[model samples]
Target: MVGAVHSLGGQEIPLRDPADFLSLVQRGPSYLVREWLFLAYAVFAVGEGVGLYYLTRPARSIALWALVAFSAGILIGIVQDAAVVAFVRQFPSDYAAADAMTRRALEPLARTVVAIIDVQQAVANVLLGVGGALYSVAILRTGVASRWFGLLGVPAAVASVFFGVVTAAAPRLSELQAVAEYAFGLVVLWDLGAAIVMLGFRDDARQDGHANSPRHRGDRPAA
Candidate 1:
């Protein structure tokens, strides 16, 4: 978004104005980079969710739900990013060269994309938040990570959901949006912590595997 603002001479482009938005979109390279960055985020989120699903096996059900919600959210995000690149980005050049009548016809399509983007963003945020919270619960219950690390996700989830709801429902609430945005740093922190622990901490991983094993629960071997 900062890149976008910089591209627009430090002024924010209003989505309500298709002309301004397409003008920004016309900067193809930067636009593609920005969209791809979001795509990368979705991809990484999927990986993290799957890893957590396996690592938090002591709380398998919650982790499964978390993985489901997180994966679903990222899947929608991935589709939305693909839609922007495949569909929305194709319009700027066409719109630029079109006559007044043609431009008017194209505007509705752009607006529809904007509305879909907003809806997808909101649903993604809510699902991710629920997933993150559940994953945190699993982590806490399993002792796979430190308490502080697990607790970090709760506020991050809250902030994400709050920002998503407010942005979709009432974008004019800039103050609340700002607060939520600031709090979203926790999400980054939690992601980093989770990755570090899940990858670097072999003892925790081994313990998780052992804890979930039937033989560890004193089950008899099958004949």
Candidate 2:
């Protein structure tokens, strides 16, 4: 039976068998849900990249390159999701049998699949970093986006680089790999929040400009 264990977080968690932990952590419903969530975000990021490319006409070259890179990155994410699904589906239930099965039937295949995904992910991360850097440059040069938003892009690009490096060095420094993943996730959430804030700020500025214009002054009768 599973038992309750205390974690470093000062929270009690259920301690299950190794097989159960593997299933829950790597191959269970939670992992599946995360994969689907990643797919959804990939869709949003691709759409946003397309919209940015069209809206920022003055930075067309940079926008276009960023679009291409983001699109490639999303494609790689999709492929990785597929591999993860496959791996999870093949995971065995019994720990002892699972080890044997993995070694005999799944390990080699899973390793190869993981290797391909890792390489693709590394390329994707580099492309993502380049795209973010280009976007930041475009934002700064055009003065269309907020400076703070542009600044956030720098760390996002750095995180992308870290992701690529950590992924390539995985299994050796697995702890660092986990940290990199968490850092990337946080950066993405921060970037999304920044975009929302920038949109609001831009709209407010536009409204203020219209209200202050002389054309609007004549529309209002004398007090």
Instruction: Tell me each candidate's RMSD, in Å, in order.
Output: 5.5, 6.9
Q: Which is the leading candidate under TM-score? A: 1
Lowest lDDT sum, 10 consecutive residues, model 2, at: 1-10
Quick one: best lDDT, which candidate?
1
Superposed Cα deviation of residue 210, candidate 1 (Å): 16
Model 1: ten consecutive residues of lowest lDDT: 6-15
145: Cα error in model 2, Å: 1.1
TM-scores, in order shown?
A: 0.79, 0.69
Q: Tell me the tens digit of each residue's lDDT in model 1 across 68-114.
A: 99899888878876766655456667777888888778777777776
Candidate 2: list runs displaced more than 4 Å: 1-27, 90-103, 172-175, 194-223
State how far residue 22 of model 1 sits from its true place (Å).
Answer: 4.9
- The RMSD (Cα, Å) of candidate 2 is 6.9
